[model samples]
Target: MLSPSLPRPLQPRANEVLPARLALSAAAAAEGIQLLTRDFAPWLAERGRANEFRVDRIPFADLDGWSFDEESGNLAHRSGRFFSVEGLHVTEEGQPYGDGPYADWHQPIIKQPEVGILGILVKEFDGVPHFLMQAKMEPGNPNLLQLSPTVQATRSNYTKVHRGADVKYIEYFVGPRRGRVIADVLQSEHGSWFYRKSNRNMVVEATGDVPLREDFCWLTLGQINELLHRDNLVNMDSRTVLSCLPHPDAGAGALLSDVQLRSWVTGERARHDVRVERVPLAGIPRWKHGESTIEHEDGRYFKVVAVSVRAGNREVTGWTQPLFEPVGLGVTAFLTREFEGVPHVLVHARVEGGFVDTIELGPTVQYTPDNYAHLGEQGRPLFLDTVLRARGDRVRYEAVHSEEGGRFLNAESRYLIVEADEADAPQDPPPGYAWVTPAQLTSLVQHGHYVNVQGRTLLACLNATAVKGA
Candidate 1:
């Protein structure tokens, strides 16, 4: 059996090759064609070029094998030629083995489209130096690993012999979104089993020094895929499950086994497991900012009339090491609901399609029996309308009085201030304070009135009247 010697210290500093292999990313993949599989090719087309995971052929030399399914019996007929792997991680000894020559090897967790788990079995044959890796894929894919276990087979060669190398073997398992994962065994039990692994967190490192040992079997991404296959027509929701690719290129190999399987939709990876918890947003404080009622964190002053919430995940956009990371959070609110007025609410402002903050919407003019529909509702329309009336934008208006107690909100006369979008709008410039001009002072004494525009004088007009001029 292969025994890997590990470093005493887990942390490896700067640009070291040891940490590089631990980095299961689009760029660092070099060991297996696991990245080149058809499912992964297109997913990382842009990323492969960016990261250089693309290669002419798949990595890892393929070993002959056989496959079995509990429901279908022997998939490989008499020759259960199992697909095995060579030159992969050996965790028999312990962690911190001398840095392996090719540092790209990683144990990826893959989920087929319709099935519960298409687990990759990371194992070593009895006293053998080679590593055995297996995966289950859709039948249509061109390259198929024939030596696979029977579907729902209890004796399907499944077991987690060792947890000793988890820190080292799996290093860091990360993904773009959320999904449920469980550990299973090939047993006679009727139902499948699951054990939570991790949530959608970006991996700082994906590979590590896998200690080799006879007792502990290596858990490869492919082997996990096989153990999860279901025999009957089962449905799965892909929205909640995360399928990991070894390299960006390896994304090509993944495929959903059954078309009808369903999975739950999830938001960005909140916890370590794929099963998303329903957070009670009841009375959860609405999005707030500094003293303003913003619909969201951004304090734009739009009235929020509606808000929608849902959950899902993003695929790999190239990252530093592990390419997957949870991008955004999910909402418990849904757009469509059978029941009227869903308890979970979002502020949909009376604004355009994009996010409109509730703060921008003026105070609800809840004048009962009189909908303020006449004012052409816009954000802070009361203020805007007042500006229009004061600056002679309107021909007529009802003069109203203001209360001494009202700070800014006045019922009788609502005084509003508005800034123009452009320069063409008329404005009553703020009352200017100035000393009387020498010419205007003399005119004021001569006549009782004075024209205010640009300091024009009524004194000249009155003087003309006194002189008998028209």
Candidate 2:
């Protein structure tokens, strides 16, 4: 047995260094490599059939283990382990910069203080790093089946609070005999829909013999990068984990130095004063709770609706829960431009009521256009028109991706990277915007609460498409 008081080394041996191996795999990746499996779409369909996955919207009264608390009107599970739907009252003192009309509003937010695990396991095959991915079913995904991490579970899930099947490959992430930890960090989730929510994003490298399940498959990093260009092929959890991988090099120089960029983000957080309060969900103003849903009076934003899920491969085969459904398709894009031949993307310091830190670096524009149509030209976001009206020649990358499928219903966003000139987006842009290299953003993502989920997704895209030798 190993000594409990042994001093550990700070760094791995030179041969075991991770970045070199990752770069090797990434550089060798081709757009259409058929090494492991052929046609992911058909394989996903077969898995769907094997799992007998099904989800249907049901009345609140039909929830099996969930009920509306009589005292606070919050929707929660009887065990109080998974998550709950509560109300948040936000009050912004000044005219915060954004497309939304109100600085103050009341809405239902998912409050899950527990930090769950979103881990992806990696192994070497013929000296190339291949990631283990699962064909998971989430009720909120538009297609109902997408590629997810090797082990995605809540504290309640792994702890057996739901009293279901054991999470496969979980031992590789949690126990003493677990795999080598490549990347492990606590990252934030959807701040708008979740109250101070965060999940542990991890990447582990397995060492010993592994039992391959029918629902799981191995693909190289290069293959995963190619899949990133496709719409909703890789789930949000996988994207966030991939973004945390050590990048090769973004560029030699940036418009703003790393110190200056840090100062700017700090100053953005200091300038805003937002007050948020947790209130009873029963009688929140401007929201009406019907038997089937709880939505805004104007039919904008999102609503809380109940769902019944039946999956053959989950920890639990059947369960009832609630999911947040957005009103329309959202647009999330990065405005990229070269400064002295060094590529940089515009980032916005955005504020959401449910965020624990009050602000995070988001994309240049992240909003549903339909939600802001009534605001007209004067109320439009700074670069919304530019992204929406860009010609084909200026577009770099475009794909439709969905949010966290387990808790969100059809919350898809048209993710893009649109090039712009000085006339469309100036160097001395609006107050809340700044330009930073993709490497700088990835550096910040290594820490928590710095880059939001949307920004991370775009950064992953940049790593795959824009960055040379990345």
What's the true lDDT of residue 104 in model 1? 28
| Candidate 1: tens digits of C-alpha lDDT, residues 1-470 | 32233212223442333213322221222223333233333432332233322111111111112222333221121232211111111121221222112222112111111112223222222211122221222121122111221111111112222111122123212122111111121111000001111112111221323344222222222322222221110111110111121111111111211111011001111111211121221222333212112133332212111111111110111111100111121111001101122111011111111111101111111011122233345322222233343444321111211111000111122211122222323222111111122222222222211211001111111111112211
| Runs with alpha carbons beyond 4 Å of true place in candidate 1 | 1-25, 31-117, 121-132, 135-470
lDDT at position 357, candidate 1: 15
Q: List the residue pairs that clash in candidate 2.
A: 165-315
Off by over 4 Å in 2: 1-11, 14-17, 31-37, 96-99, 467-470
Question: How does candidate 1 score on lDDT?
Answer: 0.19
TM-scores of all candidate predictions against the true structure? 0.16, 0.95
Question: How many clashes does the backbone of model 2 have?
Answer: 1
Q: Evaluate residue 36 in candidate 1 and report its C-alpha lDDT on the 0 to 100 scale.
A: 28
Please give the clash total of every predicted structure, in order. Answer: 94, 1
